[model samples]
Target: MNCVKTIVCIAAVMGASANTALAQHTFSMSSEVERVENPLLTNISPGGVTVLRFAPTYAFESRGERYRSRLSLSAVIERTSDTTLLANRDFPSAGYTWGYAWPSSDLELRANLSESATRNTQFADFGRVTVDAREREFLTGARWNKEMTERTRLTLNATNRRVDYDTPLLEDYRELLLSSRVTWDHSETEAYYFEPSHSRLTPLNGGAVSTQTRWLVGTTRALSQEWSLDAFGGQSRVKGAQTETGTLGGVRLNYTGSRLTSGLEWSRDVAPIGAVSRYVRNELLGVRVGYRLTEGTSVAGRYSQSRSTDVATGRGSLFALSLDNQLAARWTSSVGVEERRSSGFGGLSGRGWAVRAGLVYSYASGL
Candidate 1:
């Protein structure tokens, strides 16, 4: 079957399979490219980077009265490049992920597994390069969510990770994390979610042991028809680690109107111990304006002004603008620009601009 037809079939089966006592399967695919106008190669220089990502996914959901099952599979490839690093240097990584969700009365069970492999080269000297090899990692986890009462809920999750490198210069590693959360929702508009998690990290050959204890709290409230707020705070203590304690807090104020949804947020976050997607203490004021230009097409403009007190080491100011046009019928297109300026601290600082334009084919009907 063709791609568009396949997508339509997959989405069509989702709702019915979830409600019926039958099982069903679905699939999806996506590709994306994000290029940097000027990348930072030596950690403090201007360079160019192009990141390409491709993903294919499959999902299955079933209902069996007292027993339920949901399965997901994903394959992804990620690659990054710098024309100056090695004249044509690039690193590619492939990863696969699987997830399962089941139901049992007031309790639900969930588990996920993932593995990834990476390969790349680095510049060491003016004429010398280090042939560091690929790195491979595996992760698996399970979680249990229980409804303690009509107003309260609790969850417990545990995960373990293992890592290996193709080069002996790099060593193996292992780690585990035990996390839990409890939430009390007075209603849809007002709620709080709290979490306490413990983690430990150690090298493959019993090299070093690092530990952490963390607590997080989240809250949401609707002030009025056009205004709402979301807030969260977290505290963590680390042992055998370079850092001692870290705390984080953030708040987002949102406004809605006939043609726009605007939000402003201020946040202070700590650096994760591992390679997780995160940023510094970021503050942002953003707006989204949507106009029904035509019966068949709609236009949206989004702009944001943000600042980052990179908790890791520096300060940065950024401005971003995105323009999107959607054919209420068949296609979607977007154009965006991002300009960044920062204080060159921690040896990582730059002033540059980047632009991107993309088009995506969508179903004639909503998915």
Candidate 2:
């Protein structure tokens, strides 16, 4: 949702001080190599190819007793990757963000300003390319996370973002979303979160406008320093009789150490459309393990499986595996493979595999 955009903007400006800091500022570069295979493989076919890529990240942040600030910058470049069963093309991206926040007497104010530009071609079909789609979003919000009683605390938040997308310029959606999230913080270990948000979609094309409403409720249990459990459910109702229902429930168990962490999780989701549509259910199982092999190197891997069901699409299953390595302080590399089998019209026995690698260079400092 638009919420992710809001969070990333803040993280960019506050730099990395909110969680971790790397001695004023840090920079690094990395690259990846890949190989893929598919039934449609050909000499120049979408069968699979190998590719090399690069990325760079730079950031600097500061923290004070009552104030914080950050600036984050990033860029990525890649060309005709040979390790993927996809098309051959070049794609690059960059972003800039600045943010600040201050705490006032009974309330807090946070502001973010960000601008981003991206251009890339779709791999499968060359005709349907995003000729031009860029976005400039600004967010301002206030929040309260104080205690009203010794046993309970009521939290509230509100935010606004102005978004602009540019391309052929035929269609535009400058939507306005306003929401207030309230939570009953029973204690540090037990809390209940409830949020109700609404959005109004105004078409720049001057067509009929639409509105949507969403309601969510969630609970969290902090079992220990390295383990937690969460459960949440939400519903989205459109302007018409169209409605979407979602349910999320998950349990996480992890063992943590100074240099190693491992976790296992399971989740289930169900979505049913109101009208002439389909009902879908997803069952997921995941496992993750990470180890800091040395001061400058670390390794991690994950495995996941999912089974989905629907009306028209019938049923499907997906299995994926991935591994990541940290090198030379500034270099991070990863490779992953995923296979999916599904049934539908024109559906054949097929699978897709992706192998990716990239290099990045970063430089940042405080003035």
Candidate 3:
């Protein structure tokens, strides 16, 4: 059967097999306005954006399982000194997740799906591409977990994704991933794990097909009452016209306190370029910190950098920063900026920056 049919069947099976006991559902709505300094990440001309956003979410539980879904729609009106360059764009997206737990058998399962329609020029999940394009994407995944012993556990995961673009079809592709992990607890707050994964990629409009496999070992440790660390290293092998091997690894550190929270994340890996039907060497670093000023007020800041290189796409880099605030449980706001620089191949070279600020008002109801 086709992939889309397979996905629908899986969803149907999950819903039919779940218990029918009913539970309350939660619904919420939120709105935000954002301003950006650059609407397109290119060297053409500096632009800005005034963005209006609306989001709604619903959640429910049945028996011992839970399900949730959200939809977000937004309109972005450009703010450029040149009236000819000023235009408006709209985006709509939907996402959902279902989770089930079998405590008696030490098993848990989760499934997720999302669809998006947007004009935003950023990295897409399926491939690398030019910043200016009308894009649509569908992604879905499932995970299974089992606790074998008090000190051991196992997990299995799978995902499928597809992408489409109105411009060039460089980033349009379909992907399937299968992965497994085994964990051993060394102590109450420390554990080690080994993971193996495989991925298959097919270009939508007649490109070469490729498959990749990866293996990794990692450890997670609670360093202190308020701090924790996770690190991993691995290797990946990709089979296309020729076989290529590369290293992959990542590190994440987190801290939580009564009034503060912070994190550092870094990673380097060999993965699909997301724009073209190829693979690349990817590296990223990010840091974030948040502080609470009162019972319902908090502030946070974040920064991140990413670089990617492939034989097909050459190299590119992106940097971003943001500051956020939450007040009185119902009001939230953020300001963010981003820059992109690329020495791309196939006439994809470009550089530019964008900045944005927005506020959200939210309300929730329970049933």
Candidate 4:
């Protein structure tokens, strides 16, 4: 499989580069345990359930004056107490990511390739739960940036992604996206940009292909030393079995302080649902806040709500909070709580809550 091939390739590269003086390697392991009131957030679960998960990762990187390369491999193992729910069974998956960067005085190029597999959670978007489903994805992307002038710059980006499912309930699909942007520095504290992008999604199950095209104008302003704002307005057209045109826009505000960081965002966009092969218009609002209580301890929270503008598509909201503490130089501990609620989407609805605790240990060495 691709996962195995990725592991072998990364191992070979690491062996060949082990003798290099500037190579670095890192390895880390993490374990988490969680208790959920309803594991699947469905009526099928008889009672509360517990889940245990473990992950380990290895990374290698080599850098020079104007170029760099990085490789990473990881695996996940999960087990659950209840066997009734499809998600309750054991899940084992592996993945890898490779990236490269080349930079010069006026131009830069970057590329990345990755493959991963995990349990499908796209059902959560529609207030539904998956039944015996897993998703594997392959992604590749490239970016080019050039300085057109002292105050003007141009960037081009391309990405392709393929998604496959272990179960036939969800159809496999591939997406390709291309985009370009030109940025002008209006002042020391402000910048403006114009962007245009196109995307196509094709399903392997003989479903209608969907395409979207968008044009946008945006600006970024440094409101103050600690505050910044980004706003963009755009128009988008989506075509599939049916064609639709709509206004697309988003706004984001961020604040960075010595001990606190916060952000707020709202956007209207087109997104694809894995359960279905088409695209839907969605409006989303999100807020995140984080505070560093001490040098080694922090607390963060985030909340998001998404609503589909298309009829009967569904709406969902999620809230999560976590506390992280550095227990030692190479060890860390965290505890978190999450709540999710969803409705609509074929008349299915569910609400669930989960509490989790985790610990991580990491080690690094230079070759």
Q: On lDDT, who's better, 1 or 3?
A: 3
The candidate scoring highest on TM-score is: 4
Tens-digit lDDT track of model 4 for 18-72: 4443778899999999887754555344577788988888877765544455666
Ranked by TM-score, the better of candidates 2 and 4 is: 4
Distance from true position, residue 318, model 4, in Å? 1.5
Residue ranges of candidate 1 with Cα displaced over 4 Å: 1-35, 41-139, 161-175, 203-207, 256-258, 273-312, 342-348, 363-367
> For residues 55-172, what per-residue lDDT tens digits would candidate 3 score against the true structure?
6554543443444322222333333344333344344444445665666233334333433333233442212335555555677777788888888899988888776766573467
Error of 3 at 63 (Å): 4.5
C-alpha RMSD for every candidate: 8.0, 7.6, 4.8, 3.4
TM agreement with the true structure for every prediction: 0.64, 0.62, 0.78, 0.86
lDDT, ranked from best to worst = 4, 3, 1, 2
lDDT-best of 3 and 4:
4
Question: Which residue runs of candidate 2 sit more than 4 Å off their true CA positions?
Answer: 1-23, 36-45, 81-146, 158-175, 201-210, 241-260, 264-286, 291-299, 304-350, 357-367
- Model 4, position 164, has a per-residue lDDT of 78
Quantify all predictions' global Cα lDDT against the true fold: 0.55, 0.51, 0.64, 0.75
Question: Could you give candidate 2's per-residue lDDT for residues 31-134 as a string of tens digits?
Answer: 66655454232223245555555555555555544545544445544445442433343332223333333332245555554444322111111111122244
lDDT of 3 at 85: 36
